[model samples]
Target: MTRRTLHAIRHVGFEDLGSFETPLRTAGYQIEYIDAAERDLGQLEPLAADLLVILGGPIGVYDHDSYPLVADELQLLRARLAADRPTLGICLGAQLMAAALGARVYPGPAKEIGWSTLDLAPSAKSQPLAALRDVAVLHWHGDTFDLPQGCTLLASTPLCRHQAFARGPNLLGLQFHPEVRGDRFEHWLLGHASELATSGLNPVTLRHDAKRYARTLEQAGTVMLNDWLAKLKH
Candidate 1:
């Protein structure tokens, strides 16, 4: 059997695949990790894989000067979006997608962190996000983006207006971390220690909430990602 390639553009190490990796491997995708933040991205080509997934990170998409790879990544995303290639974005990745599509990406009213539920928009209820209805996934970012033109608003929170967006069957962007797992959440706590302290969030409370809600995401996230991958197959 031939395996499809899944190129994951990773920003930081700890915020890796989490729950999403196993499913992709089981579904017969050969995963490739590219550390775009630290490595050079100038030579990266467009539509390089069957599936392209952009993972979350601490830096903003606007910080292209500090992180020059951001520009190259956005250029790649623009080409992918224009071609309608299969792509998925989580958190920072989602914000990058928005920026690549000519939308404004900026800081929101507050840093939204912890396990929180998104209020699904009416039109968003018909698709795979239906699996996340009432599901409180991990929320770990402060930056937000405007809804890109011609994109469907999938989910929202009180802190962030544009939590998830979908453009056709090929592109999906999510602000929250549905791919986060309870078992590995400690990595996030350790990884973003300064961000947590500055944001005035309690690690104990986040741990408690992760214990309570991460299981919900475990089931719902699987359903959501599987449904999405299935769509790509068709």
Candidate 2:
């Protein structure tokens, strides 16, 4: 049997593979990363992988002018989805996926920059996301995506209606960061302190509850990852 290859695309230097890395390693998959911030997307192709995991970043999907690689990466994501390959997109990655699928990506009403609960849709109760119903996921996004046509809405929160969506059996777009862990959350808070303050969220409160949230967040990531990986056999 061949080992599954998982390509993890990183958008920023601080954002490393967190909890998701462990699970994929345990599942016996070969994991590789392409840093979109420093490297060219054309050089780091994702088409060869059995699974493609696009990690979250602080940039918006439409900021392609400032971050030119955003457009190229989104193009690669579109090709991967078109080929019916398994793809998992988180936060900004989700927005990119939505845009690639012809959906609009724009600023959300308010920035959801802390731990929030996601209300699972009826369709989410069946498969990959059933375990996340009514669960609190670690959210830190300022943008949201419109659900692409033919996609099933999986989850939502009071702030963002399109918290999660699925197109076909292979592609998933999650608005929250399920891969975040203890140190990663703290690091993110510190790295984006100015953005947090501008958005009217206190970094102090986020730091205070970081540990408690990390434990729950890890459990949630496990559930989601397990369910997602199970679909690979089909």
Candidate 3:
């Protein structure tokens, strides 16, 4: 059988696949990355691959001025969602999906930049995220998006309402870092150092927090990605 393709739209280098890398390959996917920040997305076909994963980034989906490619990404998302194709969005990517679907993506009341547990909605308990029950996912974004019309709200935290959403069986969106790899937790610390320092948070504190949560998050993230991909296979 030919290997399935998992094409990822990456905004930043450090925020690449993470735990999703191994799970995807093990599921017979050959990963290809598209750097959204470096290239023009005008000629890109969003649903050209078997699975399209829009990875998280530090920038906002609404930051079209700074990242003009976001406009192209939105156009791509519109096509993907219209086809009910398999697409996964993380953090800023999730916000982009919402915006593409005509939902409001804006700054939240407060920054939620730490490990936090989600309040699982009853309908969400039976989906791909079933493996992440009681899991404290890494939350690192200050922006949130309204649930797109006709989309199912899957999970939420105290600071954000639309932490996760799913539309039909093909599309899933996560606002948390369930795809982060624990062994490479150092990359996250170094990659986002300025944000931590600006927030008056210490790197030492993040190291300790990583020790407590990163391992478990990695394991759960693997299971969750596999589960979601399995759903796509069916």
lDDT (0 to 1) per candidate = 0.90, 0.82, 0.86
Root-mean-square deviation (CA) per prediction = 1.2, 1.6, 1.3
Best by lDDT: 1
Cα lDDT for residue 118, candidate 1: 90
Better of 1 and 3 by lDDT: 1
For each candidate, what TM-score against the reference? 0.97, 0.94, 0.96
Candidate 2 lDDT tens digits, 1-234 = 457888888887667668888888887789988778667887766578888888888888889899888888888978887777888888888888899888999999988878767788988887577766555668888898889988999999888999889987788888887777777776888788889878888888887677767777777778788878877733
Clashes of each: 0, 0, 0
Q: Model 3 compared with the native: what TM-score?
A: 0.96
lDDT of 2 at 86: 87
The TM-score of predicted model 1 comes to 0.97
Worst 10 residues of 2 by lDDT: 127-136
C-alpha lDDT of residue 8 in model 2: 84
The sequence of per-residue lDDT tens digits that candidate 3 reaches over residues 134-202 is 887889998999899999999998879889999887889899889887778889899999999898878
lDDT of 1 at 76: 92
Name the lDDT of candidate 2. Answer: 0.82
Candidate 2, number of clashes: 0
Q: Please give the range of 10 consecutive residues that has the lowest summed lDDT in model 1.
A: 37-46
For model 2, the superposed segments whose C-alpha errors exceed 4 Å read none
The best candidate by TM-score is: 1
